[model samples]
Target: MSDKKKEIDLEEIIAKYRPVVGFRVKKSLGAANPDWEDVANEIMLNVVEKIKKGEFRGESSIGTFIYTITSRRIVDYIRQKSKVLRHAPEPKPLPSPHEQIEDKERAELIAGAIKKLKPKYRETLYLYYYRDLSRKEVAQKLGISLRRVSERVNYSQKLLRKLIKK
Candidate 1:
């Protein structure tokens, strides 16, 4: 293919995979930062440009390429933020004495209950419930099958219910 044709083909592939890239980045970064969508868009644009410039040859599928680039961007963003925070002055401590006391107490109770569960159950619950991951997402993150995620979640819920009833 001509250089221009190659560039166009890369752009078309990127366009087709944009939604998938956005969804993956949004899911991975949304909880950490509300500005994640903008970050994801910026990262996607950079990835497209790199692909068009022949920097990222299509050794992987378009979707995988976008996902890998987006993942790296997120990691780099987080590392940069951490470095900034490390160099910045610490913030003032809270002045209020009783802020979120009830919430903290409830959270402690729930955490104690979770600690009583099996390791797999606890991990599954923490990832799916506390981390707010969907079943499929949880499976993907944990490197488990979707069926295993479903089973673990169901079993964990039953175990928790039984423990709570006592």
Candidate 2:
């Protein structure tokens, strides 16, 4: 797009800097990584725009200016690629119908086991395991002592195992 901006002699700049910029990009980023033509074109466009806008003040030689732009672009490209690789999302697996069925059956079995439990044991199991509450939290919620909550949870697990086995 900047090539269409007719303020500077783009052809002269391309002729002088294409080889230097292209070679630098290929050598630094490896020829196998990206198309050399694309890198060369980007460098040419940037240099042309910078010179036109007076950003490339006469403090540095033309070669140094071209090299700086080329090197910075290459570095930026690599950093962007590295970030993409590092933060790439993990693939999620879909559950098979068989797995879903088995999970449902397991939930039904646990529900039946919990239903068979006495009220105190059922309350303990529901709060401590199903609701994922800590023993102290369960005790506070049920207005019971911490030791009583712990005892109930231990007894409820044993009772649940026996009920599920049947």
Candidate 3:
């Protein structure tokens, strides 16, 4: 076997997919945080390296591959953030009662409802709502069929509504 590496045009690929990858990363990370662009660049670099190493295997389009990598990178970033929070100093106390009664009460109610959902339903809901993934993309990420993804999303939404009603 020859040792020649498949020469991919990294610049061309980057030019074509950088925006898409950045969009994916930004959507995956909730709009509350910074560093999404940096994460996108890191994901793109890793994807380029994987392509040159022949690890991509053309199972999906380069765009799809980049999206997948960016999604995982966002998840990794969140995990790292949680880890850092665990090691950091305790946060300061909350504001006064008058300030706390604004939108935070409604937000907490919704969050509690979501947490009460079944695991699979919660995962599907989070991927759809928080990650902003399409049904097909959710299927691809979760390794389920597109039809199943659609069904699960609909079912999960119903469950969420019921949970919130109680």
Better of 1 and 3 by lDDT: 3
Q: Write the per-residue lDDT of candidate 1 for residues 1-166, one digit (tens) a residue.
A: 4788877876787677767777776786653454566776788788878876777666887667777788898788778767987889545444335745876786776667778998888888889989998988999988999999989988877887777567
- The runs of at least 3 residues in candidate 2 whose Cα sits more than 4 Å from the true structure, single-residue gaps closed, are 1-9, 87-166
Highest lDDT model number: 2
Each candidate: what lDDT? 0.76, 0.80, 0.78
lDDT of 1: 0.76
Where does model 1 exceed 4 Å of error? 86-166
Better of 1 and 2 by TM-score: 1
Residue pairs in candidate 2 whose N, alpha carbon or C atoms collide under 3 angstroms: none
- The residue pairs in collision within model 3 are none
Report the poorest 10 consecutive residues by lDDT, candidate 1. Answer: 90-99
**Which one wins by lDDT: 2 or 3?**
2
Full candidate order by lDDT, most accurate first: 2, 3, 1
> Model 2 lDDT vs. the true structure?
0.80
